[model samples]
Target: MATDPYADPKLEGVSIRSLPKVSLHDHLDGALRPQTIIELADEIGLDVPSTDAEELADWFEDQSDSGSLVEYLKTFDLTTAVMQSADGLRRVAKEFVEDLAADGVIYGEVRWAPEQHLGGGLSLEEAVEAVQEGIEEGEDAVDRSGRDIRVGQLITAMRHADRSLEIARLAVAFRGRGAVGFDIAGAEDGFPPSRHRAAFDYLASEFFPVTVHAGEAAGLDSIRSAILDGRALRLGHGVRIAEDLEVVQQQGDSVLVTFGDLARWVRDREIPLELSPSSNLQTGAIAAWGKNLEDHPFDLLYQLGFAVTVNVDNRTMSRTSLTRELALLAETFDYRLEDLEAFQLNAAAGAFLSVEEREELIELIGEGFDA
Candidate 1:
């Protein structure tokens, strides 16, 4: 629906990139800068698809667009390969925060599986501290540049692996230090959140927040498991939850729809749906709805009062930023600045922060949009 999906636009006389935002579903390994990836890969003697930074970036985008989950996952193999050391983790996490700040994120929770990064002989706790150090450094840099930004870690466990409970303990151990939440990010179909019930129960016992990657690679059953078994407070790219809704009819500005129990609960509970527009298209998460931006159920969910929040699930792979995602949604749905602000508010509310902190972020968003 955008004149050019790649072009940036002004929303109600405001630059979308300059508006304050909250990123809740961002991935650490999935968001490397192309040049950084090339450099890091070279440092580890790993051969990449392209030596040129831009070429490598294009390669990632190309691979992700293949509509094959196996092909799409191969991109992460390259990213994770170079991130096996403390230095690599620190640098990547630092840049992840810096990039989010540059994209107007006031607060973000970056998620990555610590077990995947332990190949460098770093313990789970060490890897988390490394990322936390980088996050602090990035926060300081943003503050020096006259913009305040903050980021927290969401320690992730590979869904198909056996270390989820260990990762949960690691996440809870570093709560105030950096880690704010726990998640499982690998395969989501056969490996449902139900498999990690032990980890979820542990996190719940410690009162730690959990957000699961469901409704992306799977369907409604996966979403149900995320809530019931994982007790997920927020869903990572929970777009397919749209499948649980049945549209009755549209009467100019108001549409009547029927909600399945799952849909109704998710809506009534105001559980945030971390909807990544471009990534959803690339990963076929919205294939059931349609293939184009115009056909995305984002607007439908929003109109029906589902707590829909925009995100860039993989900035490099999808070649998108939160700003770009918001711009695309505005173009497709003809949304105004107020709508954009509402989405940000939803994200702030769903963030793994204290009520006071979320209120602070909500106030910051209001001030930014009013500028």
Candidate 2:
């Protein structure tokens, strides 16, 4: 029972780190420990910015705070570079689960593009197999430690790439193995989900679950395509869906707002928004609102009854964990423990799991919060 390094001071006499959480948008490549990157790079002859993990961690944070989605994405080059082998992918994935468990995550969905990891002469199937092996190993390790955690894969396809159809097939092929859903990530501005319609169509035909990276780097149009074309069950960092809302008036905690068709539909439909406050600030997703965490539309979305689930889109890059994210939001929005519980319950309801499994997660979250 090692103490969680990311634990925040108790809020309402409850340690945020000890609460059950469901991570819906965590990325495998983006969640690697800085020290692991150093050792992995050493093995593969890859050069990193700094051998010192602390310095490398700072470097990631500095680089990610560039306030441009494209600029923020450049940091992934180093992370993805080290994940180009079976062993590297396996190790990273294993540690990813272990770290989540340490942070009190009851369940998580680790997203990564298999196509990006093929540089080590491993095929798509091999890369997935390696990651699955790592996830299982991590889960077993967690069980042995007197804790329980389950993780699933969200096999991602790079939006700018032409092999989404191939990647989609790979995701569906891994169903019941490790993969639980599909997503199209990277460069969401120009490479709309419509561009990957063929893949989405195929996934839809198979009744496979889908989530798309939209409304973060882009706006309403991107979100529209994600739902209409990509058929996303959830929006990855869909914070910008706020752009569709026009604040007509405001007074203290009360405000009058007008929602456009897109925003209205998304909210009314209860399509979960995987809103990562830190990552949104770092990547300029909420630049239109303001430059600080309080400026995020997360509170607004939640108040408006949208299924707002907090997440750490990239743990290492943002230097964040779910606990830290929750602490920040609670501090900023003056949220109570029940608000935190609501977010976790939203995430559980939106998980890419069967109704029974989702209910179980919901029950676990409720019990943990009650304790």
Candidate 3:
């Protein structure tokens, strides 16, 4: 691994970032370009921390690294403020795809709470439509540039809000449009997924896919509720699932561990853990295990046959990309090309797309890796 953390390394003479990838846990508000934030803030009369894009970028990195989820979320206040208007949503979505394309992401699902964007007098339907339009525009722009990319919207509900039922409907209503799944995201500790049973029930009834934010702020109980009550097909940042595993022994490179029933089920079922290395460290999601990237349970879960996928949960806040996250893990875990490919395959398998679409993504990844 290179000392330059952000450098794209060549594994077998192929750049890691150039390899085709799939993004499942990325947040729309979290992936914004710094320049776009300034422009959007100006349009909405919002005061940002800095007018210069580079300064704004550093500001985000500093605040998120402050080790407070509350402060981390305050950054979204400015992002969502600008995203209230249809045009803002569209531009952001478009640029979101472009950024992913530049990072060699072939497929991505952008998740955000639509209910939060209704403050600018936009209806739930209109907000979703605006995002969808931007996604399409972004895809078109990529195609015109001779690079291919496809993105889906994961309509999200804020867990602290009582309008999950409405958001669930909003997600299901746009099923074939741009929306691919439903999720609940917010302060995860207090607002367990059980609180949104009505929304999850409705989503289940409609056969909509769900991914819940769990185990990042709380523990096994929250993850249990996410899977049992929320019917989550995937975990938003379920890094804390490692808590369910009891280390029995360690001898040099080998260790014996036993998994609790919850961890066993999640691993056996291959439920994807969207492990954002940097975000998990900053947010204290992996505090139980350790405070550094090496302390992250990503390698433990991966080595134990758990479905672990690398991700950038909040790109701006974490000052990261899918490539950077993978690079960090490779540096920490001494991973190679095969290890990186396995993560991409796991993410493709966990994507909210239909099995057929997921298969297509898998093929793209295989081809890219082979190249």
Candidate 4:
């Protein structure tokens, strides 16, 4: 078994970090190690809020807990500032995969907007190649350590920007190289997916897999646009889909509810909801439900048969990992091994991979959990 550096908060006497997990919504720019940020920032002569690694980590967490997605996103400015060069992007991407492997992630898809990293004279193709080189290096490093991990890139575009079509082409251009999928992230409320119709049309024509950032800072309209216009195969933090559900009666896990058309379609179709427990709370994505982890609609959605998969959207900002997210959910909702396994299976099924690869991942999860 691979050693887990962040192993803690054991479930049923088993370290949650030792169990296999799948990360579908993790951000490459958002998962940098604080020390790496400090080093990279110094190399680029960029000023950071804190030179000390621990203080920088605390700064990111404090800034992200502000109960607004826009405010929470501001911290990324510092991280992305340093990621403007090939070396910076490569190092960050490498460490991101290494960290995920140490946290027991067997398969992960690292998502980031390539357009955001072009400030340092890197063309779109060069930027993607740098990150891909880092990903391959990380996978090899894990293999050398007697463990195995696989990570793919989800090339993303900023929804507020008009480069979605260009970025979509960039993603499709790199298919089978490192990019596995495409996404549009950033300020989900005012900038709905409908604004990027041209990119979505192109992506749909190419038959590329997509997952849109919706239902986090926005309500059902954004999610509806993501499905209708963007044709998102999965939702990034689709927690707000709960707003479409009207609860009629509830007692423990047995609750009767009325599902709005949107929620019904998402559920009946088994569309995966990339639910991030801590990041959701920090960004107030779950404020409609309550203010605590226990207040999250995850349990409700899971019980109602939504394909709910746990994720750590931003590890540095949230100071979280898939292990920590699973631990928090298990503690809050009293879930067992089987419940955690179910979440991984859902993520595996929703992953942008061949059906055979997903089945292989599923078998790995079952074996890991059963052990």
Predicted structure 4: lDDT: 0.93
Tens-digit per-residue lDDT, 1-371, candidate 3: 21555767665667878989889999998989999999989877789999999889888888888666766788788778888889999999999999999989999999998888888899999999999999999999999999999999999999998999999998898999989999999898789999999999999999999999999989999999999999999999898899999889989889899999999999999999988889988888887777888888888899899999988998888888888888778778889898999999999999988899889989989998987
In the range 1-371, model 2's lDDT, one tens digit per residue, is 33545466579888899999999999999999999999999998889999999889999999999999999999999999999999999999999999999988999999999999999899999999999999999999999999999999999999999999999999999999999999989998888999999999999999999999999999989999999999999999999899999999999989999999999999999999999999999988998989999999999999999999999999999999999999999999999999999999999999999999999999999999988
TM-scores for all candidates: the values are 0.97, 0.98, 0.97, 0.98
Q: How would you encode candidate 4's per-residue C-alpha lDDT over 1-371 as one tens digit per residue?
A: 33444457688788888899999999998999999999998987888889998889889999999999999999999988998999988889888889999999999999999899989999999999999999999999999998989999999999999999999999999999999999999998899999999999999999999999999999999999999999999999999999999999988768999999999999999999999999999999999889999999999999999999999999999988899899888888999989999999999999999999999999999999999
Best by lDDT: 2
TM-score of 3: 0.97
Worst 10 residues of 4 by lDDT: 1-10
Give the runs in model 1 whose Cα sits over 4 Å from its true position. Answer: 1-8
lDDT of each: 0.90, 0.94, 0.89, 0.93
What's the TM for model 2?
A: 0.98
Off by over 4 Å in 2: 1-6
